[model samples]
Target chain A: MASQHTRTVFFISDGTGITAETFGNAILAQFEFKPRHVRLPFIDTVDKAHQVVRQVNHVAEVEGRRPVVFTTLVNVEILQVIEDGCRGMLLDMFGTFVRPLEIELGMKSNHRVGRFSDVSKSKEYHDRIEAINFSLVHDDGQSNRDLDEADVILVGVSRSGKTPTSLYLAMQHGLKAANYPLIPEDFERQQLPSALVPHRKKIFGLTIQPERLSEIRNERRPNSRYASLDNCRMEVAEAEAMMRRAGIRWLSTTTKSIEEIATTILQEIRPERLEY
Target chain B: MASQHTRTVFFISDGTGITAETFGNAILAQFEFKPRHVRLPFIDTVDKAHQVVRQVNHVAEVEGRRPVVFTTLVNVEILQVIEDGCRGMLLDMFGTFVRPLEIELGMKSNHRVGRFSDVSKSKEYHDRIEAINFSLVHDDGQSNRDLDEADVILVGVSRSGKTPTSLYLAMQHGLKAANYPLIPEDFERQQLPSALVPHRKKIFGLTIQPERLSEIRNERRPNSRYASLDNCRMEVAEAEAMMRRAGIRWLSTTTKSIEEIATTILQEIRPERLEY
Candidate 1:
């Protein structure tokens, strides 16, 4: 339990620091320790790098232990400034991998500061922005104006996590996702919504445990009939039955993260749509 | 332009493959070659690993070039299967760093298959879901009920990238962000919206180039006055003048991605709120 002592961890980058954080957190998860995280992003200049080095050294001195610093700086001078000055152990996320890649590819790295500026002008970026706008307009079956345009349409009862999944699909994967809540009316009719009938080929369903459903609904409408366990059970059962009769693919969201749910949906509906 | 010949790049992982894709993309950005990406996620077992190796080897054989593979499998058996069997260049993302980390920390990694399940149950995940719901309700000045509870309020003209920036802040950072559009009413009055005046300290502004704004608006309402360059110029000038007179911090979103915009907003309004 010696590693139980909380240590300071820095995820620093010349850009948004997102890559450093993602890679650093994955490595840190293996250890048995608590991390006091400090994120220093947009450190694209040597002056900024020097400032960060001072901060890291000050923290290392105060903690009486070497902090762990994960950096994704591509600039040689800025990287050196932090590497030489910081008292903490530096885990160079980019430096560790870029050298081998450069050798393998027989090319030199552009070593650009803030790479997203170029990405923002890409066709993929435009598609992602368009997908986000599409999802926003189609959220909660708000507007069925362009149902055919959706790459996938999600159906679930209230509080079944359809909205977040749809938005995450759009935001992360650049897929146009529209979500429709399976209300009592649809259950009574035992059919898909009128607007969604033509798009049954792209329809996916999500069901959650009745207990969890009630718990979530309770947060929005406490002690109401809509939040009652019986109501949730009936809704889920009805929704599942409708999906089964329609031969639509579905999964339970009670135990999955948003990313997991979105990935599963992609795997089932459009395996080819998976992208970085 | 020999490097222009597209090469296959595989980002394989035992979990969602998000880490592998993120890190792989960052490294790949440094190179000059165009990659034909293949993401094989949820490759948990030895059988899945073998299956992936076959596909990668097949691609290598067909392409007559060694494909580059990036992996984040934590299981020793599965990782060994990949590293030993694949004919392509294998980059073990976990193995490359975990050993040094284990030496530094003096502990073995748990080597769990899927890491996000635990994270999904954490309080941070719940807060993220709540923040998403909060951002949804507070989007576009739809609801002002919880204005005081927000960490930041983004104000911008329509199509100025307020909603996506607010949602990204909520989704990535677990921060409650509300965004409101600055309409002609506020511009004519030369005053901040009465609903937002009380929360002045938490307000940030985003402005886009008049030309870019018109282009975006044209996508929605082509050939309308709202999409005219002159109208856009007037509105942007008015909004900027109002923000300057009110002493509110602002930035131009003309050249920034959602991540860049969100990170900049956090850096300006709540520097202490940055997280992994």
Candidate 2:
């Protein structure tokens, strides 16, 4: 179902190309068109660069127009090969910024192929791995052994999008996130879970629209009362009321992506811990 | 504990600022210096822009040097406010490329506060959530109910980095990834687990150095035979031999980040499927 105005977009990088995609996506968001994304990663050699240029040219020929290519390639010779061969609107993501940065800092660019920090042996890398392990062990109230060590605790009703958000916080931000589900029993008592009370300052709540919650729960456990819209509505109401009573900061996940939810939670609960 | 040569770097955006950080980190890696990273997200208003400028200037004054600020703010007025007020070397992430993009595309930019796609209701968003749920349910050979649906299946020995990589593949790439541990039983039996045989074409292997694997396992089960270096070496050796016999593509996770491993796997097994 290709549209008449569909344009091909290529993300090229000498390393993982994730940075190229992230940067290119943000820039492409301003335009109103469908993009067919193609990622060419690990393009460090001139041979690969020439092959990439040929592929881009092929795509341009088939589409009857030049593709928009974005590259984070650091090697000048390899980048020059692509620049000389490709027939597209090429954006040099690194050259555009690295040149200015070098001049501003009065230093020479390292011109390395992979520009990611040497994190394999860094303390920050180990901390991120530990955070990932912690979040997994603490996922869905699986463990309370290290509850006190959690950077943030998330409480929400089942199917309200807690586990994914918890994992995202840990994986992306190096934060130890633990999540607990707010069940009917807790709602009957009308209090924050006892295990979470001591860590109340680090607690955040997530709520989703009842309709969406029901839809999600139905996929997990169909034809059950727990998946009924009425049940979802009642549970959501109780959870919201409980959060309000406990003075917990909460946001609706109905319209927010996992990135948005995690970012918003960090801003509210741990603004100072926002560094990666 | 700041180094004398430490410089402050700020990532500001109207959205999560993840893109700004990702792009900035790549560029910063070219230089050799410690950076004090700061992130300011959700800066959609002029007032927040003013506040950020003040903060950047204050950092420049305290450090006795100008801070390097990276911004993905899309609003012209807010961007102008920061450009006029800040004393730091401001790198307008969006404005630097958007102007030329506008001319190339023959259209005016949307200039929206948040540049992220409208993923709240898109099928892509739902697919990502589904992928996350699928990965969790199938993690570590937890279930084989939907093994056929997985886009990639990972096999490795215990503590060789399966669960985190599986979860990352699902979260970041929207791929349904399932991981299974290659235990002594499988090695002795000289075959993969029965459940993974049918999905052989989609199978990938992860191996780690025995010493590193022992260190990781020791943290979980201290002084146990399973965490001993001798046992780790045997398991790793047998696993590698089995993978070579089974003709499954494999990589070492000893010195690679999750991003590097995941990207390599995608490039090897599913290059055509690498799209957001």
Candidate 3:
């Protein structure tokens, strides 16, 4: 956000411009000023770079302020066009980091463009997609046919956010996440599900504040025992005890987001499973 | 990668160091430098900031180079500590973006920390989770019970990478993506499945090079007609013809990654759906 004066900022990249905008905004979000961002992607040529500079200068003129430009162009010739043409501050992401990195590694960079996060044709990419499919198919313990196939299995009472948390692990972390919803029947048995028994080492647990669980459940089903605080409290207490008895590690989701829960679980269970 | 001279870099943040690392790496990718990155997260208090500075300064002295810092600290006092104590270039995401944004927006920023990209309790966050769930249930045209509920339905020959593409859409863009595998039987019929007929407008088609499809299929079902190049070629050709006749938009997955394919489809179909 621009404090008293709203200014335009451009995220210019030679490829997707995703890196420029994503990283640039990381810095921008800390600002008091609000920005009107214009993204210019696929600026792979000098002509395209020149065109972007013209537009950037126009924004600066109209706004009566120099617009900030965050660029990730690896091609120095094109980057020079922006540096020379644009009246605003040109923060060259590559230039700032490349020289220092080259000195550190004692070798020249490959000078590749848009190679950091390409996912179309790599084994790692394929593995992540496969992991995501695994999470979806095994969700809510719907099928035990492949319970032994999971990297981490999550168990929690209903409305404790097992599904979303597992999906986060699969989507963001590339981990095979399978979640099981604990019901009264499980409580009655006072034992882990038969299918989960063989894979106890991979199990993780989620618990939530009973009051929050009630509110979340009430959104889906109101005035029912399932959504009742008393029922939630009893279920949560039993579920926690169940996890403890099984020696499965557990975390409370009462005040945490899916990201936090997934990250903590991954850190404690399998550190190398996380991609970024 | 820091080239010859390996140096230590720190991603300093008041909350999770995710933004700093993600964006920092994007810039660092252009260089040949192999950086030794150390993340310092949850530096919320002044005391924590002081401790981090000591560690950062230690790294600088040990390495005998000015360590590069990518910081997302919103607290000016903490930021000042790093600027004054650390011997490095401080890449302040907030410092660079905030003042201009403040002037542009004509309002002082709330000076809050860890506000951007909070996923735990937002409606958009919940929407993404719901979308992921919808994609799993509606996958492979498994059910027509809620075909009309989907934002987009992906149709493709098996092994053409339909499942992963749809899931990426659901996970990244909050699209309720449903995919249906087009089989040889459907190719012979030269029409869409009965379930997809009424909602033809929501369909997007994916086709891959037969050779690539054959290789992918080979991995799934070895030495079978399903994995045959001839079968893959025939199915892909017929699938393309059917999609053309049905007036549906389509793209080739031969040279594109899932991100490119999904992003292009979204751009042509629903450009407004993407957040960045």
lDDT of 3 by residue, B115-195 (tens): 434454677667776787788778887888888888899999886778777877877678999999888778778889888
**For model 2, how big is the CA root-mean-square deviation?**
2.0
C-alpha RMSD over true interface residues, each candidate? 2.2, 2.3, 4.2
lDDT of 3 by residue, A1-276 (tens): 335446777888877676777677665765565567766766889998888888888878887878878898888888889899899877776776666656654667666777535454677777776787788788898878777778899999987888877877886667889999888899999988888988989999999889988988887799998999999999998999999999999988876656567767876777554322
What are the runs in model 3 whose C-alpha is more than 4 Å off? A1-10, A31-40, A45-69, A77-92, A99-110, A116-121, A145-149, A222-224, A273-276, B1-10, B33-69, B76-111, B115-121, B274-276
For candidate 2, give the lDDT of residue A35.
81
Candidates ranked, most accurate by DockQ first = 2, 1, 3
lDDT of 2 at A101: 90
What tens digits encode model 2's per-residue C-alpha lDDT throughout B1-276?
134546789999988998998899889988876688899998988999999988898888888889999999888888899999999999999998899988988898888656445665678778888999899989889999989999999999998888888989999888999999999899889999999999999999999999989988998899999999999999999999999999999999998888888999998888876653
Query: Rank by TM-score, descending?
Result: 1, 2, 3
Off by over 4 Å in 2: A1-5, A115-119, B1-5, B115-118
For all candidates, the clash counts are: 0, 0, 45
Alpha carbon lDDT at B85, candidate 1: 92
lDDT for predicted candidate 1 compared with the true structure: 0.88
Better of 1 and 2 by lDDT: 2
* lDDT (tens digit, per residue) of candidate 1 on A12-45: 9999898888888888887776778888998988
Most TM-score-accurate candidate? 1
TM-scores for all predictions: 0.96, 0.95, 0.83
Once model 1 is optimally superposed onto the true structure by TM-score, how far is the C-alpha of residue B218 displaced, in angstroms?
A: 1.1
